[model samples]
Target: MSAEAYSKAYIARCHKTLKEWGAPLDGWFVFNVYDCLEEANELFTCELCGCTQVRIVHVMHNHHYFERISVGCICAGIMEGDILAAKERERLVKNRAKRRKNFLKKTWEETRYGVSLLWYRGKRLRIFRLGNGRFKVCYNNTSTECHKGKPITDFLTAVHAAFDLIDPVVEIWHA
Candidate 1:
């Protein structure tokens, strides 16, 4: 079913059930949502609607119980005051980008080389300074090669070149 249908159904089903007691649906609050992944569906389910596509609601509270309710983005918006609104989403995105940029800047300034979470050719990578005033990048986290035993001349060249006898590997991101 469409997201709107899901939201409407969810609200219809939950509005009264939650209101019969002292607690009510309108009494609830949504603090934040799951940090989304690029290609993978977030792991969660909607607490109010029984929908399984929840983006992972951080909090669904009714003053008495602070519970974690996994609600889809649609449910989150319809019931919880547009937590997924375009403006909110844009702010979140920009905040994340700023934080990432800051992290990379700090890393670059403090140390020229270190283990990075960034992936390269589906492998975790490491950048370390050489004794010869050059930089080297290697797959340091796994039992691997493809320049595993070779010395890279510089950061950029190491990332782009198929050094030694290994095939050219792609860097996933600079940071």
Candidate 2:
């Protein structure tokens, strides 16, 4: 289906789900699938407030076919999530970013010192030290250099913590 047409259908589905779930206007519907991905629908509860109240819902279009069916991040829904106090959410986001930075810094240190290693940007043990007690890190298509000194054993934990920041900010400002 065309992106716009699929988007409209997704919106309709979101409204239906909102009604069925007894969600208020303050709540938002998150459609977890692309119109083309014929899969069982799964519902996600807001991790922030745990209120099932959607402040903003976003319908992402994942147009891949060969991949083991992935749920489009709220594809059939309005930008909906929990109602977070603006300042509070922002603070949380900042904290999450801080955690991510720290995590990356530690990852660099570990990889550099040969104490531990991990893969990022398609390369295992990838890091560059700047000689000023700092390390450069790369992942996906993004790169950052960090100064904090820590040993990283769980980069995914840092990423998940960072998502806690990102999701709320998007709900507050973009959605």
Candidate 3:
């Protein structure tokens, strides 16, 4: 559907849902938003509009009714009375996903000592295999096990950890 049509439909559906719940249409606040690509095999449906195939979910709360609802980006904007903010948040999420994918696809040069090296954001990222058949990632002069001290079982995971380490703001959504 076109953006205009979708917005109109979302606004109607959201208004109906809120009215039925005895809630105000414009008082909803977006508390949290996240991409559910890694959590579920099937896409989520918007709670307000019943729209299917929603990947990025927005959690909204209404202070008056003390109700929370999960909806898609457009519906979220309608509920919150700020479509631009919703679109901007979605844009950031998409950009983060793209950056993470590109970070994994980057080629890491292997050193003679078996350390894999890649330069990111003017900093050196290194991944090396440990004697215990696990991996460790080094970035910004710091080296540690990935996944919050858990043993990294593969090179790909170590590389992902390096990306997360370098870009702390990007949430890791495993493909």
Count the clashes in each prediction: 0, 12, 0
Per-residue lDDT over 69-153 for candidate 2, one digit per residue giving the tens place of the 0 to 100 score: 1222332223333323332443444454465455445443364363334544345443444455544444445544432234323
Q: Model 3: how far is 81 from its true place, Å?
A: 1.1
RMSD of each: 13.1, 14.5, 4.3
Off by over 4 Å in 2: 1-6, 25-175
Q: What TM-score does model 1 achieve against the real structure?
A: 0.41
Between the candidate structures 2 and 3, which one is better when assessed by lDDT? 3
- Candidate 1 residue-wise lDDT, 42-144, digit = tens: 4465666676654434345556644545455555555555544623543554355344434344322223335333443454455555577566555543322
What lDDT is reached at residue 90 by model 3?
A: 77
Cα lDDT of all candidates, in order? 0.46, 0.37, 0.79
Candidate maximizing TM-score: 3
Per-model TM against the reference: 0.41, 0.25, 0.79
Better of 1 and 2 by TM-score: 1
Off by over 4 Å in 1: 1-3, 6-8, 17-22, 36-42, 56-58, 66-68, 83-87, 90-175
Q: Which parts of model 3 have CA positions greater than 4 angstroms off? A: 6-9, 22-24, 38-42, 63-67, 142-144, 148-150, 170-175
lDDT of 1 at 90: 35
